[model samples]
Target chain A: MNSVAQTFSTAALQRNPAWAQLLGLCPLLAVSSTLINAIGLALASTFVVIGSNVCISALRRIIPDAARLPCFVLIIATFTTMTTLVLEAFAYTLYIKIALFVQIIVTNCMILGRAEVFASKQNITATFFDALGTACGFTLALVSLGVVREILAYGTLLAGAHTLFGPTANNWTIQLMDQGLLPLAAYAPGAFLVAGLLFACVRTLRSFKKIPPPKSQSLIQD
Target chain B: MADLALLLIGALLVNNFVLAQFLGLCPFMGITKGYDTALATGIATTFVLSFSALCAHLLYHGILAPLGLEYLRIILFIVVIAGVVQLVKYYLQATSPVLHQLLGIYLPLITSNCAVLGVALLAINANLNTLETLIFSLGASGGFTGVMVLFGAIREVIDHDDVPAAFRGTPLALVTAGLMSLAFMGFQGLAG
Candidate 1:
């Protein structure tokens, strides 16, 4: 029980998939221009990561070492496909906007990294908690970026909530300003700049107190 | 001919895979510390991307679409890409052992690069024919290589500059990339 709790905290804070590990930046940076889109992608990725982690952990004993990567990728791809179908069915508008990124989640090093580094060796219970923590950490990163970018780009929060939440959410959007303060924040270049500044902020906060070295170096690698 | 040239230039500059479209960022940030290694990875990636795009186009239109197995594309495309990377590895091993050694880990790492898959998927999504798919992949990979080399050069210079502790490595690199991306955005008018 204690070990499980520790694994959850470590994955969530010390080794966040997006901010620290930098495993899944493709989707992280691409779809974060709007809060709703970010939330949608976050939910889909969480489902895939946790689903793949649990499945991989349960089948670890049988998967061959030489073929483990293909196996892990296959599992991740299956879950990603399921996610695609689910989104297309329930939130067709949102699905079309992020279809490419959603499909490429299979190649996301974050999911594959967890499978190779933690899931393949740990028991199912521990793997579940680890996946939960990583998913939460990833969600936090995505939502924060989403909030920042959305406010800067559109001057609105949850601008298109109706796409994800159906007709009822048509009014969920909160207009923060008459016009976006920085229209550049909606463009491709803005993503890199905002992400760079965010990283610097995180570093500044961490510098005040010493933290242990990351348990693994660069989880973005396959 | 003019349309093809436009597509090429558009993919190369206006819609660059890394700077503009945000694909293949893992390698963009990871393997870009040195110019030589970055160029090698870019070349290998270009080779894999063009070939895989060709293969994916054929497989999708020839097999999957005909059989109504389009939903299986994500899985199939990834598997095919992994196989293509392996084939590239062996071909390089037999032909150019020195180059193979230079790109040791990054060669296999290409299997997971989203840009390769992104090109393939984007080709199908845009309904490009075989020739167009090939051209687009080449252009996209070309853009990828160019930006990588440029970023590599920038990082080399950045290493010598005085930098604060909080923004030394990735943060600093990202800011440089943002500036580069801003520069690339200038080409937007050239394409359209």
Candidate 2:
């Protein structure tokens, strides 16, 4: 497997920053109550991660060893501020709802982790793919968690689509059920529960592939 | 006084930094393996949270606000928090080598703990006065420590119990935290 495929796999499943490494749980669980909010925050984070990766990888040669962490943080925080300001301008309402978590992305270890572990060591092209893959993984976790929480809590999908989309998209909210859904699914505790289930499911699935039982057992017996 | 009391209660119970708002969860989950470790992490976090709250309040009002650098608050607040963590680490190293050894890597890791920065930003956002911010930080950290110790104890107990196949480690910890959060939900209507 080439570096691109390796990085992509790492981001998507094998070492997904959200699930496998559990780097950015705060933002992962905080703003994922609704699909729109999830998309909004995910996009912002993707932008910051990609931007920071590019910057850090490009400047890797120049950044001193002692000052590496601070430099990486400065670059990440700059992109975070840029994303925050842009979102505040265009997606004002969504920005307000997620303002706290959005700004907190500066502290999201995923981006910094990518910077230190992958980007700073790799070339520009390789780093780009790594960043993209990692961002997609993060987005995957966010949207899935958001979908589950939104469906369970509000009995709807795209309930706040208008926040991200324009006025024309205001009617995009899809009602799934009338009532009887657990409201706890939309809150922080629910995020933990859903996240735990998701992690277990993934782990179980991975475990199945790890053992080709008949072939391995026969070989061992022989 | 009543408002301050309400603020304390709100931070502690209603809007808990971890179970409810999801702030500082990295440490809440990562360092909570044992009771003593969790207590150390929680107290270290509380110190950073409270100290950063005071510093952020002062900086936001005195320097950043005066310079109209509100947009720079995130970057500046993070820098401040990181600086405070370093200072605290150094202070511990100088005065309490045993404590420093106990904390180990967690001391520096506090800079990345969202609770410290979250508390600072939350206090600034709430526009709390200095005293109010201190009280709020106290409550928030107290709540954080309380939950950490609680979760630690539960996890230690669960380690001895017979658990299912897939949900042995982190998944179990999270599910336990979920149930604890549900129990904490009972405190919802107590505030306000």
Candidate 1 lDDT for residue B121 = 94
- At residue A117, give the lDDT of candidate 1: 91
Instruction: Write the residue-wise lDDT of candidate 1 on B60-101 in tens digits.
Output: 999999999999999989988999998988998999898888
State in Å the error of residue B144, model 1. Answer: 0.3
Q: What TM-score does chain B of candidate 2 reach?
A: 0.96
How far out, in Å, is residue B168 in model 1? 0.7
**lDDT, candidate 2, at A24:** 90
lDDT tens digits, residue span A1-222, model 1: 898899998898888888887788889889999999999999999999999999999999999998998999999999999999999999999999999999999999989999999999999999999999999999999999999999998899999999999999999999999988888888899999999999898878767756554765654343
Winning model by TM-score: 1
* TM-score of model 2's chain A: 0.90
Docking class of 2: medium
Name the 10 consecutive residues with the lowest summed lDDT in model 2 chain A: A213-222
Model 2 lDDT per residue over A1-222, tens place? 486898787666766778777779999888988889999999999999999999999999999977888889889989999999999999999999999999899988888878877888988888888899999989988998898888888899998788898798989989989952989888777888988898788678778877221111110010
TM-score of 2: 0.94
Where does model 2 exceed 4 Å of error? A211-222
